[model samples]
Target: MRSVLVTGGAGFIGANLVLELQNRYPDAWIVVVDDFRSGHFSNLEGFRGDCIASNVAELRLSERFRDGTFDAIFHLASITDTTDHDQLRQVRDNVESFRMLLNWASRDQTPVVYASSAATYGKAQSVMTEATDASPQNVYAFSKVQLDNLARYYHQQHPAWKIVGLRYFNVYGPREAHKGHASSMIFQLFQQMAAGKRPRIFTDGEQRRDFVYVKDVVAATLAALMAPDSRIYNIGSGASASFNQIVAGLNKALGTQLEPDYFENPYPFYQNFTEADISLARKELEYQPAFDLDRGIHDYVDWLQKERSS
Candidate 1:
């Protein structure tokens, strides 16, 4: 824990993790690596670490990470946009960049905790677990699945290194202002409400999603440093909340009772429901989600209002 690396450290979850890392390990020499593809430098307004503004694939080219430089690496950089259409770029950037980082980690024998996704579960509605079959429906999800597969291959090749992957569910919270259209529905709804507009929803807004707050996601991610083993685990609330509930929560938080305007969902490949079965994560990582939908919404709205003022 003396030296840590957080790729995509300016992203929503990574930025929050950076803050938490500083708070927890005051003496750790933290380094943030990002290409600014979707991450915002403003997100690291108070970050104290060194930054390498490059893709993980270019880490070696940039001549960083010589050897035993990073005690642990939080690999959150990837093609996170689920709607990305370029299949080749998605695989190249997400999977190849990760392969580069995995090679670096293997060479250094450093522990790595990387970001996986719920997208691997695709249309599966049953409780999501580590054992669930991967059914990726898009190129982005496919890239994540490939990353997981690569990690498994490398883990078998290098048995002693800790290479854990966290399959994050619908994470939403602070430092996500730059996600734009890719931001979560919670942030999108809050923005519409703050702008004195009705929240927009597709259809009946009954489609459920397990929206785990960014704080909880960061905690679960960091827990892998002390986790029992290096394996993929779901980091989520283990509870599903509908879009209707999200609108309701926002209304209560913003003190604006605005009914949602229903519209048809444009995308054909949409997950109707997702609820993570976090029992194994709970037992293994000792990770528990503290912010329910309502609580997380409250915290998010508070930050939103402050952002407006600042």
Candidate 2:
């Protein structure tokens, strides 16, 4: 691959993927397209690639680059905030932006590995799989469902194009601080414990989530580029960890014991549990998670401390 494009390059997962791309493909000419809506420039501090501050829907791909310029595209841009209730804005930004990218990429038949979400499972507690129908409790998840729909439609239209969508589970790791309230529970809990305050959790703190590290998410995403056909796969740790366990992990990582302040969950649409069935991704992409909850927590905490001192 000579040229590469990452849409949400300054975002949490996007930033991690961008840095990895630089390390693995030193000679590749990389370009980033981001509007900074939910992304941060600090996340791309060490990135040695060109960045275009523009939305995917508004960016004129043809004017900037001719056909076949981008060897591969990693599309991660979207309205990531799950709590935001603006249905029109969420659907428009997330869905239309993907539509524009697909229309442009069709010219060269460029391979696109885009971000999907585990939230599509809604309240379903069963292990998430690609074949399961999307329930989409929120507009953000609804928009992602639309993106997958678009992927399917475009795949049928252009049979040879490689379009892979990765249904990312609760991804948590470095470069996610900018997400604020939408950031993972692990990061939020770590912050609270580091500050000598009790971590807060909903109710009894038994709600479990499949917290896959961002590094693993990036690995599965990059592997999708070589997929033989257009399809979607679930990317996760294949195990669910309860909120109570998260507090325990944070306590161990920070070397400070802090009990969680339990409160009732205000959101009715909240998912009580999520665990991905990653067997398909393992068989198809040959992807394996290198970090589990404890390892990921320690690594992320160390990174956070380093960033604080730096």
Candidate 3:
């Protein structure tokens, strides 16, 4: 059986990717490592694997991975709360864990595919390309930026091994309810409407994002695993959608007419607009996002309603 290690395998995106990998590689032996700091074990319900309950920071390379060789390492473990005020903890938990991964990769020469964030771009201009200057507005984003830079440095030092970084934009889909405040606007709006309440949004709900679905993100990441070259690729729908659009999409999908309660956004730093220049991802990873905002929200709400009913 093919062996693969998925860090953060109990989290939102990681759980989805694990299911996909199981479907793609039916006989593969998957090792899931999750500390459950943010991820929920319910996310891994019915999953069949040897799950190691440990943090990447506290892992021993000789003892943990000495017996087996993995085809790829999906490094999704990190402190992703963008509103976190603790910068030192962000570095200690996120950057330090990534350093451990880099150390293992350096010795094992395994392909390391990590989850980078479009948060690295901050409130900069939209339609950002890979070459665009990164202006991280939060500690979490800064941590990701540090990891991306470190990935590049590792790639340079170990050119023979493939280390891919995917800069994901605003993503939403199934299995994200555990994220709570960190969940996507699409999910949050559906919750409000499902509860027969108005959706709460920031300002006029005009803040836009390149809301790519989870399916697309996983597909793109899978493609990147087979990519001939290693580098950072922007994983997002090359289009932007306003929060108002998400509200509308949810209402339409849920068969309810609900208006959004727009309040003043109090955050000092907010990303008002984000649209990825996905030309690089398309050319390199052969990745094309399958879901736009309207369709993605519709599908998500449909599944969510069924889940709730079941």
Candidate 4:
């Protein structure tokens, strides 16, 4: 059986990716690692695989480091919560864990396909291409940029190691229950509307994002894993939508005419009027996002309703 290790397999994207892999590669031996610090056990419900609830950095110190060999490693574990963590903590947890994984992967010569963030392209005037115009706005983005730099360094230093860093846009979908403050606007809107409340949107609801669905993100990740090349790719729909558009979509899906409560933008945030140039991924990985914003929002809202009812 093909063996793979997903570092944050119990979190939002990780859990969805695990389910997708299980369906696609039935005989694959999937090992999931999550600390449950922010990840939830409920996300792994009905999953049929080996699961280890532990920190990735701690796992690097164990005997499994020598015994296990994986066809590919998906490093998704990180301090993704922008508000809950400070810069130093984000670096320590994210950069340090990634460093340990890279060190081990380099020694084992194992292929790594990891999650990078669109936040790395913070406040870029134009679309974020493959170039190194990384204006990271926050700790989370800074950590991801650090990983991308590390991947580039490793690829240059050790030509044998295959590493692909996927710069993921705003990802949203089912099984993302623990996302809390970091959850997508769609999910948050669903929850608010369900409770008969209008969802609050920030910054006059004008800030835009390249909101890629979780399934598409997983497909891109899998493609990166199977691809032979070692390069950074932007995984997004290449289309942009404002917060107003998202709220409108959700209202349509839920059959309600609720308006969003507008608020001032919080934090020293990157008001990202951003879209991905997914040309490289299209040319190389044959990756194209299948879901549009309205369709994705409808599907997510339906799932959220069912999940909440259950």
Candidate 5:
């Protein structure tokens, strides 16, 4: 059976991807490796797989590294906190963990498909293309950029390795539990609204993001795993919508006329008029995003409401 190792398999995106893979590739063995620092066991509640709860960097040095040779490795483990102030920790967890995974993949000659971030395109003034001129605004973006550089370096040195990096846009969906600070805006808004509280949105509701659903991301990721060449692709809806649009969708779904309370921007966060150029993914991987912003938000809100009641 084809075995695959998914680092950070308990995270929002990682957990969703693991479940999707389990359904799609039932005969294949899925090994989940996570540190559970930012991730949680609750995220893998229904997962039935060989899961090793450990730091991915430490796992690289373990006997499993030598004994088990995976057909593919999905390196999703990283310090995903964009607001984290610890630069050193971000580097240690995101960059160092990725380096260790790359080293192991290089040794085993396994294909690697890893998660990069749209944050790498910090304060994008122009259109974001697959260029190396990354202006990372935060430690998280910097760490991802560092990992992408490492992957490029390794690819140059060892052309035989298949390494693909995906720059994910704003991802949100079901199965993302209310993990307090780590939860998505959609989940947080739904929780607050369900509790008869007004959902607070940052900025004047004009701030935009290319909100891509988790299932679409999973499909793109799976496509990347099978692709022959190594390349980076932007996984998003290729469309941008204002925060007002999001709130409107939620209000429509919930049948509530709740006005969103807007707050001032805290930090000088990257408020780009963000939209993805997913032509590369469409052409290369035949990826078509199944959910638009309205549909995705409606689905999320409905799921959240049902989940909370249940």
Candidate 6:
């Protein structure tokens, strides 16, 4: 059986990816490394795999597994809380961990697929694309920019290495309850309306986002392994959805007619609009998002209700 390593396997997207990995590669030896700084144990409730509860940077990978042991390495571990403004801590944790992993994996030439972020695009005047220059507004996005740079540098030095970076758009799906405040607006709105509270949004509720479902993100991450070359690709729904539409979707899903509570936009750096240009991902990764806003909202709400009941 092949071995696969997933860092931050207990986190939101990580947990979903891990569960899917379990189903797809039943016989594969899967190991998870998470510090639980942001990840919760409940996220991995049904996951059947070896888990190392430690920081990725501190983890002694060589002592635990030999070089060439991991057939594929999915590096998802990072300080995901974008609100975190501590420049030094955020950059160190996010960038250094990947650096250590990449340096070690480079020896055996392990195929590494890592999570980048759409936040790197910041407030783009037009649709976000890989060709567009990055304008990071926060430390978290800046760290991801550094990750992309690192990946590109390594690829340049070793042309044969398969290191792929996926710039995830606004993702939402199962096993994300642990994120709490950082959870996707879809999940958060469902919760608010489920409790008979009006869904809240920024002023006018017209701010749009490319909310890609978590399953689609997983598919893109897996497809990255098949990339013909080491490169970065955007993983998103390829379409934008307004917050007002989200409220409407939630109302229909919950069988309620709660309107939105529009409040003033507080953060000056908030992105008013975001739409991913997924043409590169389409051509390179052969990725096609199966879940649109309506379908994804329905599917996610159904799962969320079941989780609450269970």
**Each prediction's TM-score versus the true structure:** 0.97, 0.98, 0.98, 0.95, 0.95, 0.98
Tens-digit lDDT string for candidate 6 (181-218): 88898988888899999888998998999999999988
Number of the top-ranking candidate, with lDDT as the measure: 2
Q: What are the lDDT scores of the predictions, listed in order? A: 0.89, 0.92, 0.88, 0.85, 0.83, 0.91
Model 3: weakest 10-residue lDDT segment is: 60-69
Quality of model 3 by C-alpha lDDT: 0.88
Residue-pair clashes per candidate? 0, 0, 0, 0, 0, 0
Could you give candidate 3's per-residue lDDT for residues 279-300 as a string of tens digits? Answer: 9889878898888887888788
- Among all windows of 10 consecutive residues in model 4, the one with the lowest summed lDDT is 59-68
- If ranked by lDDT, best first, what sequence of candidates would result? 2, 6, 1, 3, 4, 5
* Stretches > 4 Å off in candidate 2: none
Model 4 lDDT tens row, 210-300: 8988988989999996666788999999899999998888889989888989887767765458789999998889997889998888788
**Model 2 reaches what TM-score against the true structure?**
0.98
The global Cα lDDT (0 to 1) of model 2 is 0.92
- Candidate 4 lDDT at 248 equals 88
For residues 1-310, write the lDDT of model 1, one tens digit per residue: 7999999998888999999999999999999989999999999987888998998876683256544478888999987888988999899989988888887667677788999999999999688888999999999999999989998999889888789999999999998879989899899999998898999999999999999999999889888888766699999999999999999999999899999999999999999999999988899889988999999999989988888898
What lDDT tens digits, residue by residue, belong to model 2 across residues 131-202?
888999989999999999999999999999999999999999999999999999998888888889999999
Greater-lDDT candidate between 1 and 2: 2
Q: Name the regions of candidate 1 deviating beyond 4 angstroms.
A: none
